[model samples]
Target: MNLKIVVTNGINNLIKEDYIYSTDLDFILLKFISNDWGDLCNEDKKFQNELLKNPNSKYEYRFMGVYLINNIKVWIISEYNYSIKSLIMTILLPEEY
Candidate 1:
C-alpha cells in the first residue's frame, strides 16, 4: 500500500516480551489494510467509511481498525499526515491508544 507504518514503544516491548510471531502481526495488518476492521462495531465502521470519503477534506482524517493479534486485541490506525503528505499507520494495543 506504500504507507508509512509505525509502532509504539509499549507495543514494541509487548511484542518482544510476549514472543508474538511477527507473521501474526503482519497478517492482522493485512486485514486492516483490506478494511476488515475485525472487531469494530457497525457505528465505528460507519465512522471509518466517513473518513475514507474525505480524501480531500481540509483536515486529515483517519481510518481505524481493531483486530486480534496473537490472541491479543490491538488497534491499527491509518491516517493521512498532511505534513508528510502520506498515509501513516500505527499498530498498538488498546491501552497504548
Candidate 2:
C-alpha cells in the first residue's frame, strides 16, 4: 500500500524542530522529539472527523483521533509530523471518528 503524504504549512512556525509523518498504505512512521510525540497521538476522534469532513478545509494540524491503518484503528497526531522522504506509507482515515 502507498499512502500520500502531504506537508502542511502552519507547522513551520509552531514547531521549529524537525519531524516527519510517513505512510505506506497501512503503516505510519512518526519521527519527532520523543517528548512532544505523545501529546498529539491519542486525541479525540470527534475532532478528526469534523476536520476531515471537508477535504478542502483550511485546518492544517490539530488532532486526528483514531484512524485506520491496515484495517487497524490507531491515533494520528497532526503536529510534529510532516516530512515526505521519512514517510513510510499511506494513512487511512476512518469513516466515523
Candidate 3:
C-alpha cells in the first residue's frame, strides 16, 4: 500500500525556523485532499517565478500533504533561498485520483 504524508505550512515553517532549512518560499499550492494524504501543492506564482528566474540558487518543488485534526490537505512545496516562480502547475494540469 502507498502511504501519503501530510505536510503543512506550519511544518515547513518550523523546519525553517529550526534552521533545518534556510530557504522558505512565500507561497505553496494545495493540491490533494485526503484524510491519509492531506495537503499537496502549496506554491504560489510569484514564488515559482523567482525560482525559475534565478540560476544561482536552483529551487525545487515537491508534492506534500498536511493533516489538520482529521482532515488532510495537500500542497506543493517550493524550496529556494531567494526567488520563486509566477505560474501554478497543478492548476493547469487535470485532477487525478
Candidate 4:
C-alpha cells in the first residue's frame, strides 16, 4: 500500500502518556505498510471493515491491531481519512485502548 500517513496532534498527546517516542511511531507505521508480508488475514479483514464503516465521520474511527516491527511489539490504533487518502495512526500499549 502506498497510502500517505499523518499523525494527529491527539496522537502526540497519547505518545507522551504512553512514553513512546514519535520517531518510533513513524518507523513502525512505515515499515508495516511498506512490507508486503502476504494477503490480508481474517483478522486484518475484520479490522479493515471496522475502519471503513465511518472513516469520514467527524468522530475518530479506530481499528486496533498488534504488529511486530524490528522485534518490538507495537499496538496500533488508526483511522483512515478517505478524503485525504491518509492513515492517521497512534501507537499505544495494548492495554491503553
Candidate 5:
C-alpha cells in the first residue's frame, strides 16, 4: 500500500484545543513515518490484560505503536483510509487517550 499521511482536522483541532502539545508534532510525524516501528495487535491478551488492569491508562490501537520520544513514552494512532490510499496519524497525550 502506498501509505500517504494526512493529519486530519480533528488532530489539528486537538492541537488547537491544547489536547496535543504543539512541540511534539514534529517528533510524532518523524516517528510515524519512520520504517523502524511495529504494528499494534488489538487482540493481544497481554495488551488487553494491561488495559483492563488500568482502565485509565493510555493505549494505542491498530496500526498504531507506542514510542519513546525524548525519554517520554507517547502513543501514535493511525487510521488507514483505503479509499484514498492514505493513513491518518494523530499524536495524543496519554491522558487524552
Candidate 6:
C-alpha cells in the first residue's frame, strides 16, 4: 500500500507489556496498512469497511484490525482527527479500549 506506518502510544505499551518482537510488530502494522484485518470475523471486517465508507464526526477516518500475538489477542486502530489535523494509530488488548 506504500503507506507510512505509525508507532503510537498503544504500540509503545504493547512493547513494554509484552516485550513483543519486532517482526510481529512489523506484521501488525503491515497488515493494518494493507487492509488485511488479520483475525477479524466477517462481521467485524464488514464494520471496518463501513467505517471507512462512513466516518463519524469524531474521527474523519478510521480502521480497526485484530491480530493474535503469542496467543494474546490485540486490536490495532488508526484514526484521522480533522480537528487536530493528525492521524493516530493505536494497538492494545481489546479490554483496554
Write model 5 residue lDDT over 1-97, tens digit each, in one string. Answer: 4454445555567667776665666666675556224234445535544544554332223445665544545566666565775555666545567
Q: lDDT of each structure? A: 0.77, 0.36, 0.33, 0.55, 0.54, 0.72
Output the better candidate (2/6) by TM-score: 6
TM-score of 1: 0.80
lDDT of 3 at 63: 28
Off by over 4 Å in 3: 1-43, 59-72, 78-97
What overall lDDT, based on C-alpha atoms, would model 5 receive against the true structure?
Answer: 0.54
Instruction: List the candidate 1 regions with Cα displacement exceeding 4 Å.
Output: 50-60
How close to the true structure is residue 36 of candidate 3, measured as C-alpha lDDT? 23
In terms of lDDT, the best-performing candidate is 1
Q: Estimate TM-scores for all models.
A: 0.80, 0.25, 0.21, 0.39, 0.40, 0.68
Measure candidate 2: CA RMSD. Answer: 13.2
lDDT computed for candidate 2: 0.36
Rank ordering of all candidates by lDDT, starting from the highest: 1, 6, 4, 5, 2, 3
For residues 43-91, write the lDDT of model 1, one tens digit per residue.
9987877766765532466677887766788888887776777788998
Q: Residue-wise lDDT of candidate 3 within 1-97, one digit each (tens)?
A: 1222334455455565673232222233222321122232345434444444655432344323333321323234323323334322231111222
Candidate 2 global TM-score: 0.25
The root-mean-square deviation over C-alpha atoms between each candidate and the true structure, in angstroms, is: 2.6, 13.2, 14.2, 7.4, 9.6, 4.3
- Ordered by TM-score, highest first, the candidates read 1, 6, 5, 4, 2, 3
Residue 83 of model 2: what lDDT? 60
